[model samples]
Target: MAKKPYSNEADYVIVGAGSAGCALAGRLAEAGKQVILIEAGGPDTSIMFKRPGMITMIHSEPKLKKKFDWGYYLSPQEHVNNRRLVATRGKVMGGSGSVNGMIYVRGNKENFDSWEAEGNKGWGYADVLKSYKRMEDWQGPDSELRGKGGPIKVLENPDICDAAKTFIEAGASALGVPVNPDYNGASQDGMHVIQENTSNAIRFSSSRGYLTEQELPTLEVQQRGTVSRVVIEGSRATGVEVIEEGGQRRIVKARTEVILAAGAFGSPQILMLSGIGPAEHLRGHGIDVVADLPVGDNLHDHLFMPMTFAMDNSPHHSSAFYFGKALLKDRFKPGSNFLAHSVFEAGAFLHTSLSQSTAPDMQLFAIPWSYPPFQDDPVRLSPDKRPSLSAFSTLIRPKSRGTVRLASADPLAAPIIDPKLLSEPDDLKVLLEGVEMIRAIMADSAIAKHVKEEYEPGPGYTGDKLRAEVIKRVSTVYHPVGSVRMGVDERAVVDPELKVRGIDGLRVADASIMPTIIGGNTNAPSMMIGDMAGAIVLGTGL
Candidate 1:
């Protein structure tokens, strides 16, 4: 196979084709500028993309390697459960959003406000709110807070089971937590139905939303293309070197800019492969230095420990039930799940310590049933099961940070992902408090009626023993950020405008630019970043 060259130079060469890349490509191409969108994975027009909770089926499909997943795994974590967990990123056009849980959460206002406080001008809640509204087409009652006429569909899942609803109401009432209708509203301090990225029983990934109605005369989307290096010339990113399907390598030049949206892991890997990482790390790999900024330092992700309680009632909490209903061609056809079933999905933000910042240090996601363990084979629990309600505690504002270093200057080689989870003793203390809080919620009379026993770590486990067990079973909640932090400081990789520091014609737009992790799920915030990045790149908004 011969390598293909860019016959015509595009105004914008967007790499990765993930959430941010899709938005950027759509917007830039719509603006009448030539754009080339390259994706490591293939297109996301598969049947599996429509199933709501079919993450397992999607992951198991062998086509994922060729289509929409990078399928990267982390190096061992000394602090975590001593296992190298799988980190599945979409190799498809829509990126990870195509394969993620599809829960749409915008985090808290304080999270964005903190960016402004850190000298990142025009990134506060007030500025990003418009971008959020601009990107979403919400289903429920729209107000000043939610959007009604955007590409992405944000709707509440109506097919949530009766047990799930009872679980939320009972659990929140017992714990004195308010029943908040919208977490994305004025405050993010209550429980409510989870908002999802579904429209008519299909997954509405960035690719679908951004490119559906747009007509781009000069936009070309290439899938099954792997980026090997960012081509820099005289401190300017001019283009990229990539390997196509049959392993043919080519260098495609960009006339204007090369925007990297390869996500937290892929972006850093490309930067390092292009000799634009930490000085010593680059030299160690025998790669000549470019800008030598911290490309992969300050890595962070949301760490979660699942607290499971066996419910007394035999609640219908099975994936079989959900998917079976979807497969059956009864009166309950497509989209009926959203109209009928009511699964209670709610989040709570709390301060582990009174002296902490305004944002909630601990974030909780209450689910009606227990799914299989993270990265487990078969991707389903055994048929012998029980009714359970799980409260997952995520260390929202972690103090400890990690790094993503190259394995051997090889883009194909997996990056060294050391999140340094629980490196700070304070993190453990807060997590411990979260564990206690979940226990208290389950113990409450209203919630207790649904519970039969504690399954994980078992009953009669308390004090340091329980604490140790919590650490033993904890896993990542899939919210990785800050590997390429944004700021005006010397250590920062990108500036407030998301432009790479000390470099021109290059910018990073993804979760990688977050200076710190937000208080809740990162999907909505990441999309917000994509929206803001599009506006910034187009010079349309502040």
Candidate 2:
């Protein structure tokens, strides 16, 4: 059969050209299947998108956020001081992968094993490991655990600061554990340097790795296009109706499948707009129900409380100064600056007393600067001018869940998002334990030498007061997932193969399909999901 001309149709129509969408489209196209990848945002051609070090700047600057981020705000949480936290999701071509911290964490093996245990067959670590290895082109030395000659290029943080190194050493000393050379490898516990999707001093985003790096004759990318809804006829998804920037709407037919790779929030929003969520909710929105399944339940995310320390008599300058230097260097040298090192270079995954499983419940990030002096959004404040060290204690396995619902039937309107952070008592307990551990690590001899004084969440607070401070300061680590989950039971929106329940030729191939939030940064896993989703659709999945 001859290939169809690139028009308003294709073999596969993937919405959202982000981390997962890019990979899924690339895979299908490489296999000779015509694909159309649609992105709401423009291309990933900005300098801010290319530089590895620009992440800190991106979060700190509101103008940049306006251009790159979805700018969604979670509802005020009753558990965490009623604070309305901002959810920073990428709106660009590469999605969050282009604007995130760039840390590449594959999550714990137990994360996947548990998914399979929950009747989601073939999702165990062993099955997904093949996908991870298949998507990675690691710069690390030869190892069967890691891979080479893959789509995404992975590299270690270059020019790691002295403070980050000391923090890693201090973590090992405080925990009485050896520094694990690779957390993404055999073990996820202990201190280690984080690897990211970066190479040759540039960010290797999913758009760059999969869409731009290779030529796929069968793939077509449509930018500045927002998907309004999945076009369904009876019980089958035929294609999608997309709204262009000029308010023009058109339908792009999908001959085989319509895959939603639009992240956690967007995927659910699109589904509900297409009348495929809870029946009551769809009726309230004036939309007819196609499926009465849970489309937006089980929303969960990681929360981190930052601990900053004043650096006295430090060897390195302020991160702000280095950022400025890098900016100037970019004008002359280009891609040859210290900004290549993502801010949180070294980290540790440790288990708290509250942890029920062997996998660590908390994660700590070491920053070489005084980051966000206040508890508000990092976008509101620039890096402190003074030299400082900061470590963030993150609740990796949060139990609290929330929901995503359609604010209205309007496709342009943002969805209502609520992760209900720290609602579970044990989640707060794990976070408190993480704070204690971070305080201990700061006291270690390796890191104590540079410390001047405890900064924000300052000294003399303990017990109730400390808990209050924790409530006041804890914020999202920008990892939100599990809204449109995959499983075999009642709450599952998608099945083992990521096919939506009660819908034919419709699948979800992004973080939204995760039944349980993985115990690490979700970018890598989302990409793997996209990669393997293509295989599953092609009848080649493990």
Top of the candidates by TM-score: 2
User: Which residues of candidate 2, in runs, are more than 4 Å off?
Assistant: 1-6, 312-322, 374-376
Q: Each candidate: RMSD to true structure?
A: 3.0, 2.7
What tens-digit string does per-residue lDDT give for candidate 1 at 346-436? 5566666632666678877766666444442223234224666666767887888889889897677778888887887787777877877
* Per-candidate clash tally: 16, 0
**Can you give the lDDT of residue 284 in candidate 2?**
96
lDDT of each: 0.76, 0.87
| Candidate 2 residue 393 C-alpha distance from true site, Å | 0.5
Clashing pairs in 2: none
The local lDDT score (0 to 100) that residue 47 gets in candidate 2 is: 79
lDDT of 2 by residue, 1-542 (tens): 99543369998999998899998988898888999999999888887888877776667778888877888888888898788888888999889999988889999999999999999888999999999999999998888889899989998776777878888898899888779888889999999898889888788888999988989999998887889999999999999999988898999999999999999999999999999998999999899998898999999999898888887633445556566876898779876656665766888889888889989998988877776755456576755567777888899999999999999999999999988888899888888888899899889998888878887677777898889888988898878899889999999999999999999999999999988889889999989998989899999765
Q: After superposition, how far is residue 514 of candidate 1 from its true place, in Å?
A: 0.5
The segments of candidate 1 whose C-alpha lies over 4 angstroms from its true place after superposition are 1-8, 60-68, 312-332, 337-344, 373-384
TM-score of 1: 0.92
